[model samples]
Structure formats: C-alpha cells, structure tokens
Target: MRNAPTVRFEAITQDNWEDCVKLEVKEEQRKMVAPNWYSIIQAAYDKTYTPLSIYHEDKMVGFFMYGKDPEDGLYWIVRLMIDKRFQGRGYGEAAIRLGLELIKRQEDCSPEIVISYVPDNEAAGKLYERVGFVPTGRIVEGETEARYKVLR
Candidate 1:
C-alpha cells in the first residue's frame, strides 16, 4: 500500500475559504461538529479564534478552529473535523498533533488545551484520548469536555 499523504495545517484565507467550507464530515456525524462555514463565520468575528484548514499534501481534507477563550482565559480547540472522504486515514490525529504544536508555540499559551465533542461521538473521544487528552468531567452546552495538559 502507498504511504499516506503528509498532513499539514494552513490558515483559512480568503483564497482558500471556499475550499475549506466544502469539506464535510460523514452524514452520521453531522451533529458531532459544526459546519466549516459556521466556524469560519464565527472565527471571523472573534479575533481570538483562528480557523485552519487541514491539508493532506496539497488537498484540503479537514477543518479545525482553536484559540484562547476570552471568558475563561484558557486555550481551546473548539472545532475539529475531517472530511468524509479523508476519514480513517490518520489525518485527524496528525492534524491534532500539528495543531497542538502550533498552540504550544504561542508565547502566551496556557498549560492546558481544551476540546469538546458531542457526548455520543466515541470516535472523537478515542481520537483525543490517543493524543493525550483526558475527560475534565465537565459538560457544557450538551458536549463533554476534555483537556490535554501541556507538558513543559
């Protein structure tokens, strides 16, 4: 089998925003994550949030948004989703790892990184756990929260 394409993160820009919005999760997972268009729009109004597109080689395959929460002063990975066509190829994990690197590189980053998903999205829970996240035992807005403690 051929090796999987390299996964990398790119900023959601005006030139690539349309491609980013075109990415979609599987039908069964529609409720598990927000649509890219919604996320892009939200991020546009919130300067703290940075929306990014996940690319496999040169092709856009997913979308995620991360930033520090103004209300709590904590960093959060508020969104993550791989397109239906790219699921199960390890793109999600790679993207998260890269995202963590990006966040950790921030000079003012917090010691913990937070993420949440619909309580029933076992796949998301497993994926986050595999990357060192643990449940924080908090449910906000109907989603279960988990955190990755940033190691020094």
Candidate 2:
C-alpha cells in the first residue's frame, strides 16, 4: 500500500507569502477559486482570518483558510487550493483532513465545517464528497457552493 502523506498546518506569514503566491491553478480552474490568492495571505497575516499552508513532508503543497462565519457561529472554509504542480497526488484530501483536525483543536468551535466551491467543478465536488462532505442547498454570491458538516 502507498504510505499516506504526512501533513502539517501552519499559519501564513511574510516568510511564506512567496510560496503561497507561487502556487498556480490552471487557467480553466482559476475561476473556481478566490479571485485573490495574495489577499488570502494578507488576510491571515493581518489577523482577519486564519490561513494555513499545507505541508507534505516539509514541502508546501496546498493552502486553506477558515474562520467563523460572522452571520453564523459555524466554522467556514473560506479558501482551499492545491498548487497546480502538486494536483492529483492526494495532497488535497490530506490537507482537508488536516484542516478539520486543526479546527477540532479549538475550544467552543462548531463541530460542523462548511465550504463553497463552484458547482461545475466536478473534480472538486467529487473530492469533497469522497471525504464526507454533502450538499446543504445553499448558494452565495450567485454561485452554487456545497456545504458540509463533519459528523463526530
């Protein structure tokens, strides 16, 4: 059996901004992600949100941002992406699980986790479902994004 990738989550910082900016998504896939990747790093560094770099065996491979939805108390996954060069290597799934684990470490945080992604991106939908995320029938910014909750 293939060994599972080792994953670690670290808060984004100035030192790591370059790594985050250097990550790329294919032209076809860019619309499905946040319009500003650099803003994600800035937000995290500015303390506006929690941005995490996903490292596999010490190499930065992916990123995720999470925070409480101001309108609701539930945890929300604001942004998630795997570097184009690192896609299809199972790093995305590992990074997601690592994010969930990190959220669980917080006190009084909701057991539920929610995420939004373009509905047309079948690959993303499959990945989310394969990892136990289900649709919540909610739409935002006129875009269809599936919401998922972690069942403990």
Candidate 3:
C-alpha cells in the first residue's frame, strides 16, 4: 500500500480560531458535532481540550481536538473534522495516521488510541476502520464510540 501523506499537528491558538470556526461541515452533518461551532471554539480558548491544526504541505486543512483519558490510559480523539471544502481527499486518513504516530511517540503512554463519533457517520466509520480502528462495543456520554490499538 502507498504511504499515507505526512501530517503535522500544531496546538490551536487564538489567531487560528477563526480558521477553525469558519470550517464548514455539511448542514446535514452538523448534527453529529457536539456543542456547535461557537461552543467548540469557545472551549478551545479555555484549554479544556487541546485543539490541533492539521497541516499538510504548510496548508491548514483540518482540525482535531483530543485529551488523555485518565481512566482508560488511552489518547482520546475527541474531535476530528476536515473542512467541508477539503473533504473527499485523503487528508482525513493522513491526519489520523499521523495522530496514531504521535501516540506511539509518547513515552509516558502505550499505544492505545480511542475515538468516538456518531454512529450514523458512515464516512468516519469507514475511515476509522480503514486505519485499523475496530468497534470496541463501547459508548461514552451517549455517543457510540469505537476503540483501536496499535501493536507495540
């Protein structure tokens, strides 16, 4: 198989919040997101979660928010959204693979990664499965979530 594209994650900042805010998800898909655009951007400022700007070739194309799950010892991918304009390319997969690589590099943690999304999101389910994440048969906070692990 061809190698996934390189992706870099930079911590989110106020200067880039607008770029994230303006990210468009199809109206039909908006229901899958939590807290809406305004709340998500607001939370980013408070540092409750860490937001990462996904970049490929110096272009900002996607955003993801995540934090460590203290209970499970897994890096939780809380939010991952590609700009509507940038969707359908391979950026999502590239970004996800890069995230997994980052987890592998964390010395404090082992290679367990977990992510959750609405069950109806077929595209996300397919992407996660494509990258080796299988359903963990677990639900969190009322959302159907799946878990995946990278073998050490």
Candidate 4:
C-alpha cells in the first residue's frame, strides 16, 4: 500500500503564480468555483485577499483564497478549487482544514469564518459542512452562505 502525500499551503508569489493559474476543475464543476486566474487577478486588486497554492508533497494541486470581506467585515474562504486531476483524493478537505487553521491565526480574524457555494453544489456543501460550516440561511451574491466559528 502507498502512503498519501503530505498536504501544505504556500504563498502564491510571482514564481509560482503562473502554475497556480493553470489549475482547473472538472468541466461540469466549472461554475461551482471561480477559476484560479480570475481569483489571482481579483486578489491583486484587494490587499485583504491572501491567495495560496495548495500542494500535495511538492506538486501544486489546488488553490485557496481566504480573506476579510470589506462589505461585512467578516472573514471568508472566498475560493477553493482542486484541479480536475486531483479531485476525490481528500485534497480538498485537507486544504480546507489547513486554510481554517491559518485563518484562525490571522491577527484580525473574526470568531466566525464564512464560505458559500452554488445552491446545487452538493459536493461543496457537504465538504464545507464536514469541516464545521453551517448554512446561515442567507444568500450572498446568489450563493448559499455558510459559516464556521473558530472555537477557542
């Protein structure tokens, strides 16, 4: 039996930005999450948005962006997408756990962290719920809003 690769997060710097932008989801899941390039570009204009690359061992397998939402003054996991080739191997959940841990360490992090997804994205809903997020019954920009509170 083979061992699973170690998962970790790395800053999306100029050296690895291009590689991060090249990661993609499966065709049917395209609408469920924003593309890496768009998220990276969006992060550029927003200082609060910290984009990070998700790596399994030394291979970049996904992208993550978590930050404070200026409008609500709450922290959010704005984006998470594992490449099509890496889906279903537990990378998503592992990245999310690491992301949450990092978020809780932020100097200004709120007690609650938010995340949202298309109403029909069962995989996302399940994934988020499994990681401790509960739907808040609010829709933000058409996505179902959910939140996870940092437990002290």
Q: State each candidate's clash count.
A: 0, 0, 0, 0
lDDT of 3 by residue, 1-152 (tens): 66667778887676776776677777788888753365466554755456788877877888877767667777777878777788877888988888877767777654667888888888898899999888877777766777777677
TM-score of model number 4: 0.94
Model 4 lDDT, residue 35, Cα: 88
The candidates, ranked best first by lDDT, are 4, 1, 2, 3
Alpha-carbon shift of residue 98 in model 1 (angstroms): 0.6
TM-score, per-candidate, Cα-based: 0.95, 0.87, 0.84, 0.94
Please report, as a residue range, the 10-residue window in candidate 4 with the lowest summed lDDT: 1-10
lDDT of 4: 0.91
The residue-by-residue lDDT of candidate 4 on 49-135, one tens digit each, is 999999998899999999998888889999999999999888998889989999999888898999999998999999999989999
Candidate 2 collision pairs: none
Off by over 4 Å in 3: 1-4, 35-48
List, residue by residue over 1-152, the lDDT tens digit for candidate 1.
Answer: 54545788888888999998888888999988889999999999989999989988789999989999988888999999999998999888888988999999999899999999899999999999999999989998899999999998
Q: Which sections of candidate 4 miss by over 4 Å?
A: 1-5
Backbone clashes (count) for model 1: 0
lDDT of 1 at 134: 98
- Model 3 is weakest, by summed lDDT over 10 consecutive residues, at 35-44
